[model samples]
Target: MDLDEAFELVGEFGPRQKRLTAFLVLLQVFVAFQSMLIVLVGAVPEYHLDLEEIPASREVLAKHVRFASNFTSIATEWYLIKHDAYKVSLAASLYFAGLLIGNIMFGPLSDKLGRKPVYLTGIFFDVIFGYVSAFAPNYEIFAISRFFVGITNGGMSLVSFVLTQEYVGKSFWALTGSLTNLTFAVGIAIYALLGYYIREWRFLAFISNSPGLFFFLLSFMLPESPRWLYSQGRTAEAENVLQYIALGNGKERLSVKLKQCIGAVKKDDSESGVLSLVKHPVLRWRTVILMYIWSGRRKSTTAFLIFAGIACIFTMCLPENRGGFFFSPSILALCGKLTVSAAFNIIYIYTSELYPTVVRNAGLGVCSMTCRFGGILAPFVPSLKTLGPSVPFVVFGISGLSAGFLTLLLPETLNKPIAETIEDLQTSTYQMLKNKKVNQLEENS
Candidate 1:
């Protein structure tokens, strides 16, 4: 019996699983907070430069005052006063760049070192850097600190999601994974509320960073993925974790059954890396498709939103600014957000199901890295405004639509057992193709 079979005997969504899943999902709140904090922290506030002190020609004074009034950004608190608003974009891009780097480094590290350690280390550093960002004396320092924060944020978010999925049975994969993202949405709302009340960015930063402390404390209670332990030939530890899980579900007697299953299960000690995704013929195509879909999803979502924002620019006559949330533009924007968010949730769950345990995190990391690349480039998409207002949207829309079409090529994993090894994946692919060929032959006959 495999780990998934054993999980069924114990209880898939038992009390223990719920507890662990909740704790891990809650960690996403801080990830959201740190990620979206830039929306407010990088905001360029409207301000005026005092022209009374400096003597200048009337025309020169007018020009200086006009430029000063337009020159605004949180980074301007330190420097870049003479620079264009791209400084803010650069700072934001650096944070996403850090996320890209973290995903590259920590995804495989979790597979090698274990999920618990990587997650704990990520949260610890996330907290440290969060505080550093709050107290940064200069814009350069703040940007650097935020970059580190992004690195930790990327690792923590990836590990936590993978860790959560690892604990549950395949039947609950979609439910649990999608539900986990809801916290991130809630965190965004909470940040908005905080922004409304707290005028100071530093104070808001401090409050946002405070949640990582709580998460770090709660993380101690999380156990290593039992499936991972079993894969590593650490049957004794795996048994202990399963026993704890069974006990939590009030099925302590199943411990013996779990032990028997664990004994029969073979361990996969093979090492895998990013390249492993493409090493096998079957997995290689799947990996490529997954990467493209990831990139397309991000590009589509970001570009569409930017397009919607441009639409809002022309429709400023709407009452949304007056107080109503049901304006046409607002509703359209919300719908787009909802659609993209649901797509994100589905893709995350889908990617988790597609990869084997040996390289699951790595696969996720690479896919997420591609998604981050989209994010890194998303900021620049708006610059296409120089071409035309609809031009960026057209580009994003085409990418998104193409991605949507290509998704039909992916094999359905609904109610399917998680693939535990590359051999399992290859065998399944072979059998599926053979069956398809047989069906076609029968039709021809």
Candidate 2:
């Protein structure tokens, strides 16, 4: 069949295929929650030991903070480690750095290798490191373990975004994308519940990640992306995977319609290197703009949120202020963090759908990395507690508003067909901008 005829025929099957794809891709939400619980566990603790409780020595307080900074120190029941606040602060930064490195690696890796391997690898990495974290002998080991956890967590992060765009029909992509964040919010809620009961940080770490092992084992049954397979010229393999999806979703045995549907996609023989991302003007813009939005959002949001939480801790601790139980302030700070988490998800889901598939993974990676970079400076926020928590909030609020504006810069994909190739994106985005200009001119006239 001719290209026009092929597109017409494929349109009918695309929606149904997208349904199956949504179920498969949404599994990443579970993975994301499991990966993030450790961060929450590490970060959201009640600062209980009073200065009076420790010997009247600055060195002792510093030692305590350092001990707590170590993952194993967090697990220690006997020693009230005080001085290592800086270490804990640094570990938190490392956790985010680990997440940054993982996000950066997954994009190129997913582009080179197929999605399933990376997804499964992320799960396994989380599982192995998660268990190691539970039993880490010292703060140094625990700090290193958190970095590895970040790497695995990053892989888990991208697969869902990629899968949703690939499998779901264009119409459902935006809302489907948002659902991952909503589910992540639910995970945070679960972590909160777990935190209440599993006060022992080591046990909390173990329980939080235990689900990842199960998910990794379950991933064996998950099918690889047929679109990815087809893109690489593995036609038969793509067809085989698509057929299984059709059958799994209870469609009648693979019809010739299904075969012809995916068979129609053109192969991408262009080099899949870093340069490929910059080779085209449109693709290059998508990568950079998305990266900027991501970076701005993460940096601003994370920095402010971290500072805010530290302020709340100080408020709860000071007798001159509304000094109350330690958990009271920590809980309030945790509640405030919910807002940050919600904003991050909303922006990410919207941004992921903004770019076409040609640059989707690259775009998402840049955004994710941007957020991680923002998180890198998050540790320093505590130093500014004297300026007030609202200061950080103002910064994050601006970043969020800026990112929201950037989202407006993106062409909406609703009702529009998903762009599966570089040519399609170039034409579509060009015409979109052109139409907007024409509308502006017509309005002025």
Candidate 3:
């Protein structure tokens, strides 16, 4: 009984698998809170950059307050870093920068060392960074803390999702694949709900980061992956984990299934790394297309579209003196925000399906890295207030349009079994071509 066979024998997703997967999925919600907390923590209220330049008179301050009304964000409680729009955007971007770095480092590490250690290390960092950012006394300190949060969140999101999906049987692959998106939605919703009431950025950070402690404490309840252990040639440990699973699942064929899975394990000697993503014929193109379409990448059309759309709305909301609609611009902005969220959710599921299991974490890591870079660029987009409206739109619009066309090049894996090895990826194409040849011969006969 090979590992694939053992998986099939388990008879679809059972209660034990369901319980374990549910815990794994919760990791995403926590990740979302840490990463997306910037939406609240970085919210800069109305601020006057020229305050010191102007007089200290009440009339002068009042006049500048009216002048500052041109900006977006609240004036509630900005760290000293809040004086400039570009600076504020950069402060928000530091978290994403951390995310990119984290993904790059941890993806390969998990592939080398197994997922649990890498994942727990990330969660531990996520909590520490979250609190550090909350209590950071200065802007530079806050940004540094956010960078670590990004690192941990990026590592956790990529490796954890790949790990969870690896344990899930194929019967529920597509269904389970979308669970991260659901949890992310829940996390973002909670962030918005808290932001509405808390209003203070640091307080929001405190509440959000506190959950990581619970996750870290509960981490012991979960076991290291049996599949990962088997892949690394730790057959004894793998069997022990499998036996433990069997007890909860009430399946009697644990020994038989364990032997089958272990006997079939094959070790690959190739020294492939991130560069290997683009080295294989099929994987190279697959990696390219996935990066192009990944919703998080800076080149993503959704960001440009949303940016352009929001810029257009802000134009309409501009006063008649500024030559605009002057009516409330709330609904259109809300819809645009929702559209961006939906596109990202779709990308998360799509990227996971496209890559084979061996390189799944690495592939996601690269995509995640690009996405963070895009996020880094996103802050500057709002600072383009000096460039006039059409400039930002044109820049983002072209990227978005190009991404849409690029998405059409990738293979659809809606019903396909996920490839577990480079051989699987390479051969699937050959099998298709062989079938085509057979059909042509049959027509002649």
Candidate 4:
């Protein structure tokens, strides 16, 4: 029997199964560390350096502190070095561009290579670039590092969704997917609480990066996805790996099923590539919509977030213009950051389950790209502060909500076997929608 047949024959087991399952959960820590590192890129150490001890007014102090928290800020400082607003906007734009380039490449890679290897490689790049960013002697190098970091780190983010979904039993897919992104929310919450105590920018950079070393070690302990191995026609190795997984999970060895699965494996499958994706109508449509959604979501979130942060900064920087009770702009920025972080995690779970496995990576990639692109547009909301804060929020909120509505177009894949190809996807959907009405009529008898 195949693995599916074997699952049916053996049926589900009990508490001992839970003990074995613990090992799977343990693997997520490495992915989670990567998530935490990517988010910390925004609020770096230089942000707090000069201002923390300044005796001058907020505006004067901000200038002393290098008030340029992003790449735009860096650029402005480089040229119009004294113009804080221009610099802030410029820095935000640069970060968005980084995400755009990174996201464009991350999907194809995960699709071509198995999720595990690509994920580890991405993390390695992130740690290396992140350290380089810390020592960047100038704004241009810093921007270059940030852009590369975004690309590498962007790939790292996708693996959590892919790996967790690939390895676990179908029943646990939603929960694992949700928690994988939820790591960001948790990271943001921790960052918020810690931000007050840790004001030095460089020290913060050091602390943020320290987790990556642990990931470098933890990657060794993670098993490559058996699903990927099987797909690649490495059945013997896949089976051995699966046996260990079963053993680790306290289940009986499934040798016969492994043999059956291996026998079923055939070569000459469709390779994942840009051309391959574009050639198929279903994948083509899925890719376009997903990319639109991904780009829109990223732009929307980033635009609103930077808008809010800049507004708060302006408030703190100007006394005559300062309105209301005073909380430092940094603290306010933390609030916005944490809010976006929570929203991102919640949205990803919903998006991840929205496609069949045949196109899961493709679909998720499109959606993720949408989110990142929305963030890219986020930094450019100049009129929002000049016009009103509510303006940007409303615009972004509407854009995100619109993406949520588009989500309804997708079917939920929870508890379903992962589809293997476009044909599998079509047949599965046909049965779900087509057979349902027929079954209902027959049931009336």
Candidate 5:
């Protein structure tokens, strides 16, 4: 019997899995905090020039004026400069860039080193860098610190998510994944509330980064993914972990069944990597489609709607500028957010299910990397109003619709055993293609 069969014996979504899922899901809150922290810290607060401080000389015409405000941020702490727009944008962009880099580096590392260690290392450094960012003396240092924080965020987020999926049975995949994302949404809300009350950016940063320390301590309880262990031919260790889980679930007798099943398990010693994903016909198209869906559907739709909504409401919805209640851009924007948020939850679970175990993290990393491009580009989307008010929304809407239609090409993974090897994935894909062709032949006849 294989890992899936062993899971059947041990019990899926048992008390042990529930406890583990809760811990893992809680970690997502901190990730969300780090991901959205820049919105507050790098915010440009309202300020007016102190005309008295300005030198009235022809040679000093280009000099920046002294500005004063009650609000404290990277923007206001340092006087706004001529290139303030580019500098602020860079600070935000660098974090996403770090996220991109982190996904590229850590995804493969987790596949090679195992999930728990990579995740822990990520959390440790994330806390370290979070503190560094909070205390950064200059805007340059703060921006650089945020970049490293983004790197750690990418690693922790990806590994923790993959670890969550691996711990549960196929039946709980969607439910647990969606639950974790709900926590992320909650985190974003909490961050907004915190930002509202905490006027100083440094204080807010300190408070936001403080949770990582607690999460780091809690992470000690996380176990290595048994599925990953089994795929790597560490059957003895995997069985030991499963036995522990079995005991937790009060199915101690199932440990004996796992012992028997382990003897029959054949180890596949083939090496797998990111490149392997595209080397096969079955995996190549699937990878392409999944990447496109992640980049366009998951990232673009969500980012565009959220940013566009904020832009319209703030810029166009003054009391004098308000439109009809039902047909208002604000109402339409909220609906768009609701639609995309649901899609975000589903795509994460779906992507995790599509890839096989060996290259799962690597494949996810690449897809996640693509998704960051949308994030990196999202802020500038609001600036596209110079072209047209509806341009950004239309672009995102079309991309989302196209990706929604393409999802039909993906095989349904619900209630199916997770693929443990590339061979297993290929065999399943072959069977699916064969069935499709046969059905088409019958129709032609």
Candidate 6:
């Protein structure tokens, strides 16, 4: 009896498992909601500065013409000029900064602390900071609030994601993966609709942040990761959780499952620290490749939508004088966005499946922190208009393309057993692939 047997006895894709996965999928929706809410929450309405006299000549356009949104952002309250990209998008940038910090810190913490506690703590802060941002008196305070929200989002999201993947069978990861894409799409569409209906920024903030509360409440219902418990040499608790799972799953003879778990439990020889990722030999190359993907920042389903948005913006607003071209920049941009998004979704799912359980969170965290840096830079992209509108898009496009090519270097994990330890990942997977090649050659002979 081994770990694989333990997973089997628990009943893969059983009613209990599906029920839990559904709830977890629901939570992923809110996580999607929380992440994308920023795009619309501070939509600034257009406005104009008071003019004592209208400008007679076009040369005076800079003085009289003030660029503004139809709805003023909550931060601006009054008016902001077009060139002030920092003021307009700084909160989002700061939030990404917080996300970066969260990614760096939470992975190791969760590995040390167990997934549930750190995850719950993140939810607590997520719930608290979420609402607090609505009442922010100034842009600076709002930025700080949003930053903390980003931190909780990054930390909890990583841990919770691992837990979600762990609870279900490997074959069903695709189902869960589809749920991730759907929720992301749903989150974006719903937020857009909410923005259209809701006029006040603070009201929108409250409405958007309300979902965090549900997650915190649901935190009580979530089971601690049995795998994490086992890894930490806590078989009693692991057995208890397994029993609970067996009962919920309507499987008979919990004793057999317990025996399997006991047989699988051992001294955790795998290095679980964040540094272990770079220090270990096989893991080092894996980390480097992962970092490349991270830097490319997962140009997937959700991200491509963002690119499509940029394309749409340019399509409507492209200068009338540039009508000589058959296809406008915006249309081209939109197509690129769609392609990138689909590719990203595929790559990101593959990334999650590649790492073993012990260091999965850590690997994901460091990788996502790299992504946050990209996020941090992303908000500032509008500022690049000073150089040229197409400059930013080109930069991002190159980044996405490079990442896709690098992703080919990674091994496929579809339907394969997810490794539970570094040794299992480095040694077992290596041998597994080696034996597979040998068997193929023997068959050919």
- lDDT of candidates 1 onward, in order: 0.74, 0.59, 0.65, 0.54, 0.77, 0.69
Q: Which parts of model 5 have CA positions greater than 4 angstroms off?
A: 52-69, 256-271, 297-332, 380-389, 429-445
What is the Cα-based lDDT of residue 163 in candidate 3?
63
Off by over 4 Å in 3: 46-87, 199-201, 233-239, 256-270, 295-343, 378-405, 429-445
Going through the candidates in the order shown, the clash numbers are: 0, 17, 11, 30, 0, 11
Q: How well is each residue in 157-268 modelled by candidate 2, as lDDT tens digits?
A: 6875677655544455555666665666667777777766666677877787787776677768767766566555565776566555555455544442222333232335
Residue 315 of model 3, lDDT score = 35
Off by over 4 Å in 2: 1-80, 253-270, 297-343, 354-359, 378-401, 429-445
Q: Output the better candidate (3/6) by TM-score.
A: 6
On the 0 to 100 scale, the lDDT of residue 23 in model 4 is 37
Q: On residues 1-445, what C-alpha lDDT tens digit does candidate 1 reach at each position?
A: 4576678888899999999998888777888899988888777665455555643444444354433333233644543333345778777888999999999888888877788999899999999999998988777788898899889899879988988888988788777787788888888888888888776778889999998999899789888998777766566788788888889989967753333322222435343667677777767887888888788622233344334344444333444465456556467456545655567777888888888776788888988899987876777888987897656655665666566666767777765666666656656655755765787799799
lDDT at 115, model 5: 89
Using all chains and alpha carbons, the TM-scores for the candidates as numbered come to 0.80, 0.70, 0.74, 0.67, 0.83, 0.78
lDDT of 3 by residue, 334-362 (tens): 55456555566556666766765556678
Model 6, 1-445: lDDT tens per residue?
3344577878766777777777767777667767876677655545574566655543453456554654435534523344443565777667777788888888888877788999999989987998888888766777789889989987987787777767766666666766766676777777788878886778888888888797788778888887777666676787777777788888766664333222232455454668778887777887887776666522233345345444545554566457556456645665766665665555556666776666778887887777776655666777877897666765665666565566566676654666666666545666866765787799799
Worst 10 residues of 3 by lDDT: 67-76
Residue-level lDDT for 312 in candidate 6: 45
Candidate 1 global TM-score: 0.80
Clashes of 5: 0
State the weakest 10-residue window (summed lDDT) of model 2: 1-10
- Candidate 6 segments whose C-alpha is farther than 4 A from its true place: 51-72, 76-85, 258-271, 297-335, 378-401, 430-445
